[model samples]
Target: MTMSSLTFLDRERSVAGPGYSRWLVPPAALAIHLCIGQVYALSVFKTPLVARFGTSETAIAIVFSIAIVMLGLSAAFGGKWMERNGPRKAMFVSAVCFSSGLLIGSVGIATGQLWLLYLGYGFVGGIGLGIGYISPVSTLIKW
Candidate 1:
């Protein structure tokens, strides 16, 4: 994409000016964190998910395991990318991934497809978790 086509998410455009509110960073970062942290509440759905997918609790639990694993992996690997590109892009991508993951995982739940849970809430959401996590910290530091 050309510079002209760049969205607000572009680091160049997202950069704060002299009057920018550094105080705004914490609230925004907190919001992102709250959204991402919701994944931890998955255990409450374990029994329901097991019934929905006709799977054992262990199998359902694997979804959480995958998500946590991917979160770690993505954070470890995605840090440099976040550093190079800046936080706005990373957080936007993170939001998309997270929301998409929830949608996809819901579809999986609706359709009784176990793998979709693994792919959606597990893989995609985990990427979101990682990116969402790092973006704010980096951005706050920069600010």
Candidate 2:
């Protein structure tokens, strides 16, 4: 992605134009929230994941637990940085982290390596989830 897309450093230009509708922001935020919130449904695939990976249910559940833990950690630690850098950069980074996690996790699954799955979906993706999760809240508050 281009630098402009990742970082909206210019505070003035980042603001909504005069004709913009404030009401539209909530729906947009809701869309993002809905997408991120799907992580909670990982349990739905627990049985299939167990069979595919030949692992116990507890092992598979670690992925969810780790990601959730990291989400809170990153949000708490990264908040100040996100504030300084603005939501655009945070959101972009989050998107990259989350997307990369899925890609890497796929590789891990294909190779039957549980560690890769944890690293990808838990550590890295969790960071993305945390940052992306908070981005809209900050932006909406600013608006």
Candidate 3:
């Protein structure tokens, strides 16, 4: 969890040599979008979550909505921090947050705590999605 570990993600390093392919940038950006954009598919889990938690569909839907809302808020608010620090850091942190949210959400599921599920997946994961979704745009623009 040091900055040095994230050097490979640096914009300059991505094209550090003449052999680097500018053509690859779009695909890389696409991959990022495809990955983070899977949030839309989360609705597929609604029925399963309801059965597992014995909760109403509305509650689960609220969790999904909260995550989306937090995504917007974090992206808007975190843009400046990303610009100041760098996309590499932002992306790495987002990965951590995203993964951490999943892990935390699992704990909630195991313990049957709805609040923990919302805090973990909705709030934390949403922040990760926001930061991750926007992380590569600046780097792509720079290229």
Candidate 4:
């Protein structure tokens, strides 16, 4: 075949069959995850919590640390589940858990309840982070 024909065939193969649109999925996925990654921005709420609850910085920092540790643990344990369930479902669940944690944490701060912060931001939100992190990793590897 001519050089031109070879190039055309390559292009055809790249776009054909079970193959995806090379130009689309990556950026679309990145846009979504960028928004979701805001969970890691939890520190933004720390000052407000301290202001409302009059809690010590050490206490607040401990709360954040618990959340991070839980996140890591959940991801480690749930990575297989994420891969089996698919990224979209995993991401949706993660969003719900993460948001719920923040809301609960807000209530805890308003009421001066430290336990609520642990429940909301540490356990719930941590689970969300774990699931969200694993959800995309496998998908990208497969892709």
Candidate 5:
């Protein structure tokens, strides 16, 4: 074969076969998970909410509890969705929902609307956490 033809063949083989270094994928996934877990650190937002809205600590705590409960529910029920849709797609969707929740919560805080906090952080972000939590579990298990 010509030099160009040989190069083309090599490229095709790399693309068609197991092209990734399996060792690298796990560490990369770990890094991503660690970063994403910071979502749980959302307690950091509580002080600002309290300062701005003058809401009680118990009320703010309830919001966090609701989000956690929803996260658990979504993970349990959405596992099948994750399985059918594939982890990458599920993760993408989860990230969008999660980010959107933060944005909505910010808007709610700015507007002084407590309900928006519930809708945004508790509901939307909870769903993201749920989906994200499960997205990788089955994938890793299969691997």
Candidate 6:
């Protein structure tokens, strides 16, 4: 977390130098934002999820609700940690969490477990979304 504790994903190595171009940062940020923004497409699966889970529409909606709520909370709380740790590390962590959440959700869907879906795509993935959403902000501002 500290400069002395920098690891492979640490931001120290990524620090823009005199010749660095700010243009590159926006593309990287946009790419990440685009990936994280897929959650906005959750509605596309709404009816299918409801049918697959044999649950009420409101129940299925909770999954998205949870994800959105987690996104807000994580972004609010994680912004500082993202800054302190640097975007490189934050992005890696976000990717891991988001991917893991998707895997977990897949298993849940196969096993027919609603809670797993809630825990995975909703909670875990949401954290990824939040961190990913905020990680680029600091870097963009720094430039």
* Backbone clashes (count) for model 6: 0
Single out the weakest 10-residue window by summed lDDT for candidate 2.
Answer: 3-12
Against the true structure, candidate 5 reaches a TM-score of 0.81
For each candidate, give its TM-score against the true structure.
0.91, 0.89, 0.86, 0.73, 0.81, 0.91
Candidate 1 residue 66 C-alpha distance from true site, Å: 0.6
Q: Between which residue pairs do clashes occur in model 1?
A: none
Candidate 1 structure quality by residue, lDDT tens digits, 1-143: 67689877777777678998779889988998888788899999999998888889999999999999989898889999988887888888888988888889999998899999899999999999998888888877766
- Show pairs that collide, candidate 6: none
Candidate number with the higher TM-score (3 or 6): 6
List the candidate 2 regions with Cα displacement exceeding 4 Å: 1-12
What candidate 5 gets wrong by more than 4 Å, as runs, is: 1-17
lDDT tens readout by residue for model 2, 16-87: 778988998889888988978977988998898899899999999999999999999988988898888777
Q: What is candidate 3's CA lDDT for residue 40?
A: 88
Displacement of residue 76 (Cα, Å) in model 3 is: 0.4
- Per residue, candidate 3 scores C-alpha lDDT tens digits across 13-107 of 44347687788878888898898887788799889889888999999888889889989998999999888777777888899988888888889
Give the runs in model 1 whose Cα sits over 4 Å from its true position: 1-6
lDDT of 2: 0.86
Predicted candidate 5, C-alpha RMSD: 7.0
Cα lDDT over the full model 4: 0.73
> Cα RMSD to native, each candidate?
2.1, 3.4, 3.4, 9.8, 7.0, 2.3
